[model samples]
Target: MVTAKPSLELVAEVLNGHPRSISRLISRVEARDPECRPALAQIYEHTGRAHLIGITGVPGSGKSTLVRELALAARKTDRTIGIIAIDPSSPFSGGAILGDRIRMNELTGDPGIFIRSMATRGALGGLARASMDAVDLLDAAGFDMILLETVGVGQDEVDIVQAAHTTVVVSAPGLGDDVQAMKAGLLEISDIHVVSKCDRADANKTIIDLKAMLSLGLRMNSTTGWQPPVVRTSAEAKEGIDELLAAIDRHREHLQHSGELAQRRRRTAEMRMLKTAEDILRARFISRDDDIVVDLVERVITRALDPYTAALNLLATLDEGKSDDGGKKRP
Candidate 1:
């Protein structure tokens, strides 16, 4: 006799804060397993309650350190937390190269905090395709706050803006030209700008440059009259972290009062739905005969058909096939 798959009840138990089941559920979601859908459906209702916070910036800006400090500060309020650290993937194993858990050793053994490190797997914006799903799972698992730390890639880090309710862009002194942060499009998406490593000698200069940039209206202003505040923090020294946390709380409050929280959640849902539909379409396209795709590619290579026209033809073929299947199922 074959063993049956775990029921949604078991998954629900996990969502009710079962520690052992959390990682297993996340793995299933990451693998895109069909069996995970029922659990996700039930868990979906419990999401949107957690405060989703995104932390991103250039490499060596001390993002991981700040994330740790932020988590610690949040714990002081007796809030449970979840952390998703997106690390660069190893070329050979496609596993997270940097051990984020090791860096967050201080938070270990805390039942209230769940930490997960995901490999980017070459995805743009330094996020895995399953990052959002992981977030939802954590939210359903009853974490009061969720922090998403992106791989420290420059411009592409903007993708986190759509995934989190609050986006924090971190910068530090001695990381080269401070002006580069303004040009990299970080200001536009940031809900809070953190000048990290304030203990450094040039930290004051970095903070001044950030304030100057904000004063110039380079950062996008929220319709709620909320201006993204630039906060200073020395994660290593644990100085100014409370101020940074307060800034995040103020931004959250602003979003709630201005009705922007609902708007942001709606946008996040729209993006996730679109990404799912795109993945389904791509899979359907590739599931057709291999020879057909090979032939199409060969024709394009030999100038027999342009790529745009070929794509249209392929889409048409897929549509016709779907119509044929529907007809067969009728009566």
Candidate 2:
């Protein structure tokens, strides 16, 4: 006798704001369990309701602190929040080293907020595929706001732009030349520029430089026509948190009014679908132990077939298999 699989209905309590169920569902998604797909399919329909926000900046730019403050403030407004903090992977354990939960200890006790820390796990752009899936689960769970905090590796941290409805680029006063650094794709993707640690003396300079850059039409590929606002915040002091939230609200409104929000969600869905298909195809290819792949590898090693040629042949073999299946069905 076979064991019965868990029903998604069993986890309906998770969808109804049960923290334990939410955690278990996210874990199942992150593990990429095959059974989770059906449950995720049901959950996906309820998504696109939460406001997804991406926060990224330099390593010491105080992103985690700002996120904590933001969560605290958002809670006061009666909003439920789900936060995904992406941390650098540990070299040995391959887990998140910084542990954002510890950093956000204050908010842990709050029933309205859920915080999850994920490791980069060799994924570039500071996010793993699992992280995106987890975000979907959180959104489906009915959170009013979802905040994604990246690993903060400068210009390469642009993946959040695709995943977030509103991308906030955080910067501090003394992180080298702000103007020159902004030229490296951050300016293009930023929907809101935040100058964290505003209590520093050089904070004004950073603000001015960002404003000058914006005035020069530096944003080339923004999704919205609304100019990105620059807001200063000292997360430790909690100053300007309200202003930052206000800017985010305005950007959210702009996205809705300018009809960019729907476009962003559509783009995100398209990308996710393509990525899922790619992963499935890749897994099928790797699992095949056929003589064709062995022969192709040997040919490449012997310099008879170039890698590019061998790759095309492999794909051709897959297509041929599909065609043969179709022919058999017709007969």
**How much does each candidate deviate from the true structure in C-alpha RMSD?**
3.2, 4.0
> Which sections of candidate 2 miss by over 4 Å?
1-7, 90-95, 218-223, 291-302, 320-331
What is the per-residue lDDT of model 2 for residues 1-331, given as tens digits with 9 covering 90 to 100?
1123363753576578777776777777766677777887877777778999999888888889989999988888999999999888776877667566766899987888988888777677767767878887788778999999998767666888888999998989988885587676787788999999999999999999888888788455443478888899997676999988899999999889999988998888887788777767766676665678889999999999999999999888887766766523110
Model 2 lDDT, full chain set = 0.81
Could you estimate the TM-score for every candidate? Answer: 0.92, 0.88
Q: Which lDDT value does model 2 have at 190?
A: 86
lDDT of 1 by residue, 120-196 (tens): 77677767788998898889889999999998867655789988999999989998884564555777778889999
Q: In model 1, what is the error at residue 2, expressed in angstroms?
A: 16
Please list all clashing residue pairs in model 2, or write none if there are none. none
Model 1 worst lDDT run, 10 consecutive residues: 1-10
Top candidate by TM-score: 1
In angstroms, give how far residue 248 of model 2 lies from its true place.
0.7
